[model samples]
Target chain A: MIAPVRVGQAVRLAEWAPGAPIELSEIPANSAKEFILPASETIGRYDRDGARFTMRETTPEGPRTVLLGVRPCEAAGLAIVDAVFNWDSRDEFYDARRAATTVVATACAQADADCFCTSVGGAPGATRGADVMLRLADGGRQFIVESLSARGEELLRSAHGVTEGEAAADPLADVPVRFSHERVTGWLAGQFDSPRWQEFSLACLGCAACAYLCPTCHCFDIQDESTRTAGVRYRNWDACGLGLFTQHTSGHNPRADQMARWRQRVMHKFSYYPEKFGMLACTGCGRCARMCPAGMAISDTCRAIDAEESSPG
Target chain B: MSIAEARDEAPGVRTFRLTFTDEPARARFFGQYRVGMFGLYGLPGEGESTFCVASPPTRTEYIECTFRRAGRVTTALQDRGVGESITFRGPYGNSFPVDAWRGRNVLFVAGGIALPPVRSVIWNILDRRPEFGDVTIVYGARAVADLVYKHELADWQQRGDVRLVTTVDPGGETADWKGQVGFVPAVLEQAAPSAGNCVAVVCGPPVMIKFTLPVLSKLGFAAGDIYTTLENRMKCGLGKCGRCNVGSAYVCKDGPVFTLEQLHRLPSGDM
Candidate 1:
């Protein structure tokens, strides 16, 4: 039932655009990585930049880029990046691309080993940051397209080649309800001086891959890029996990030890972020635990913040 | 309710006029807030720097600050043009207890760009003249070229009750210099105010304060009678950012200003 689509050119929305919901179903890709990629891979290597995705693929020049049949996690990932982009300096490169694109998210049916959304405070089929969302039914015949944002509504209005309809809410809660947030945060706050950090961060490779793969991690470093004739100063995504990440020219490294760096990672997500924005920075995407070659699992970290085994020195 | 504006004052020194960028900021500290006293400074690709509300609280709309181009963030600011879009986060840090210094004789001691944040207190005293005693300024620069608040200096000189002394180090161009030529600590010793009745506020290069303190004490100024402001590279303006701290004391939280009595007990390592 799914097919390739160009909105506004072919058919109309399955329903009223803004007021009604629109579901974007499986539209096959032109190739392996044609579109619907992270701006890091698509636009800017370190962050969102014009014509600079991670893969060096340029955003199509003329018409708006439509990433149809996208999932909610991806959309949520985009929203997480927005905070970092606007933090110290507004990255117009990231903002403009986000403005030009529409996010239509679908519920994820499968969860992988690297998935820890439940632990980090995300649900399997979450609708937190998506502009538009759709839930695929058990029978796989119809979809429940939910409009989550203004852009989602606009996309729904102009969407084409679909039947307009609403699907019943899932009878069971979509979120995996295993983790206790209060328990985890309380445990973390009290374990600041614990030795567990030393043992736990021992295996950290300092490769920064974890930060790179994360859906919410957004620290960056700016450097000047130039080849003999022309140079453009650019900022790229940076990871605190790396040893040299915060090193100063004076040769003093503030977060030099892996243990201290690990502490900052958790603190930023649970303690610091909430103190400022009244929200947690971690989305529990579980990508870091999954991608870490060292087997760093944020799940295991929950109970250990108490430093259960380590005696206070 | 408050807004941030960039007002250039000198080379590599920007007087960022910041107030509240959001409504909540105004609701908490209104009337005394300026649209410009609350500002967050960050490099385009780096991070933000926390600052004090340099504009006098009485202005209620502009918090001005002047920073030197010592690090990456300030260096980036040098390249930016006025009215260019810049992101700021706060009017962070504990402002000088201007409301408390009301009835006391206030002496604003500034060296080089250090005068920027301390300038807030100076202007406030001028604005609300009824609140405090006579004003005395002991300010210095490495060279005559380095002094900020030049044009403002002229106005300050005209005030009968306010005493002003401008100095440059001995190495400075002394030909045209009619003012004192020596270090701040040395000049403070010579221009010894009646220490018992006056509150001495000093802000300047780190080395300068290190030397100035004992001199103030020799002149009979009690440790509690003198105050100095502090600065360190900071980000997130909010204490949550964690970059601007010295020990458990986040400069953003505990202070950029400390009374000499407090400074004596504080671990020198923190600054």
Candidate 2:
């Protein structure tokens, strides 16, 4: 079985050993973002032979593999990031990597306080980014598998799994909807100058742990790294929570304070992205809320925004 | 595809006239570009940098870009020779509505290296001079050497239809300096062009714009009649990189050009 194996402090996707059982009960701390959009990769390299310079695009190197036991929320978050990477100018590296990977999502059986996929048009059994979905059987000894995409049907055709008689019963976890997504988006539209942003973001340490761990946060910076003879241009993750995210070279920062940065994060997800792409930038994975050191919860943030009375413009 | 000509416009700033290696690339660029649109220029290993297509849309033979040697890509661009090749991706973003301003007076104000974006519109208007009314240009820089487009500035001064007022900061004038000696906003107020039936296009560093906008307001320039460009940090010029944003608007997509009224609608204290 392919499953997440505990590696030191973090859980990583790996092959399950014979003696070691697959861990699918708890959600892994890390999502499958690296598998699709890697942490770092050289997009292209340039070589200068005397006065003649030649450049070549780097071909992606990885075998096509299926990822098993991804949570439903994490699976949905992948689709959110997919929209950004494929918006207008498609990222070749991400497209290549995504083409080589297939996701098999598992319905969440347990959830903590941070789980709120229901509020953002997601559910425990949501099959948004998953090719195949797996649910536990009534006796808990086996998994009832279902194919969601054409690729999943191909994989299922060759599998040795038992019967395909009748459809299985509902196999979704219980997650409460904390706030209305439409209400949150409407609230965010008018909160550009709200003092609540400063109040809500005062404790934010600008750690950017929320952005780094989030599955749908796709802001990136491109730069060139050079040796004495050759150089390569690469793209890496950039966090907007930092003050320097929108700083101009002339020492003028547009998003100057932590509150402005925090506001960008929320607005980009609920308002800006929705206006542009016709979809929310979040999939309610709740990783940002779970990993935040400041006790900041996106669920709580949305709820608070929903509760605020709108003032005349 | 290659730099046909390069000129040092100011200290740390240079302008390069690029000609495509292939006939199709040259044809395509000239076929569909307008005033105030920008291009992403760089070498493959150096990554792309965004800047205006500096050359006017009227001169469609070759494209030119003026940039200051500040960042990594600009420095790499500075080292390139005439025969070297660089990648280009654009004529992206919306263009200025110069056609709509026909029969209206045009006021162009620029500062320092921010001249490139405005220079595109300036030349666009000048090419069709008879289509517009009185044209006034008020430009300033930190010093005499910091002024860009010097050749064009000299030509503007000689034109019968154009009124050009050049300036340098108080201490930036040389012995032979013949223009006004003050900041751009102060000089703009002194050489105040009438705001009636005119569209004022301004581009500069943030501080210059912050001060100049109020001066234009006091001079009776309507907020809808004032235009500026946001040269924010960008990566993918296609609005996907998610960096060049001030509010809900993506500068790479929704603008590089915006009216003061549109700017007012954006989130305050961000820009």
User: Best by DockQ, which number?
Assistant: 2
Q: Can you tell me which runs of candidate 1 are displaced by over 4 Å?
A: A1-63, A67-71, A80-93, A138-142, A164-178, A225-231, A243-256, A306-313, B1-101, B105-131, B134-271
Which parts of model 2 are misplaced by more than 4 Å?
A14-20, A59-63, A166-171, A309-313, B43-47, B218-220
Write one digit per residue (lDDT tens) for candidate 2, span B42-85: 87556778899888879877889999998777898888878777
lDDT of 1 by residue, A97-215 (tens): 56676656567665555555666556657787677776776456666777877888888888785566555644322445345555656655566666777876788778877666665
Q: What is the interface RMSD of candidate 1, in Å?
A: 8.6
Candidate 2 residue pairs in backbone clash: none
Docking band of candidate 1: incorrect
Question: What DockQ do you compute for every candidate structure?
Answer: 0.06, 0.57
lDDT, residue A188, candidate 2: 79
lDDT of prediction 1: 0.60
Q: Cα deviation of A313 in candidate 2 (Å)?
A: 14
Per-model i-RMS: 8.6, 2.3
| Worst ten in a row by lDDT for model 2 chain A | A162-171
In angstroms, how far off is B141's CA in candidate 2? 1.8
Error of 2 at A309 (Å): 4.2
Candidate 1: DockQ? Answer: 0.06
- In model 1, the number of clashes is 32
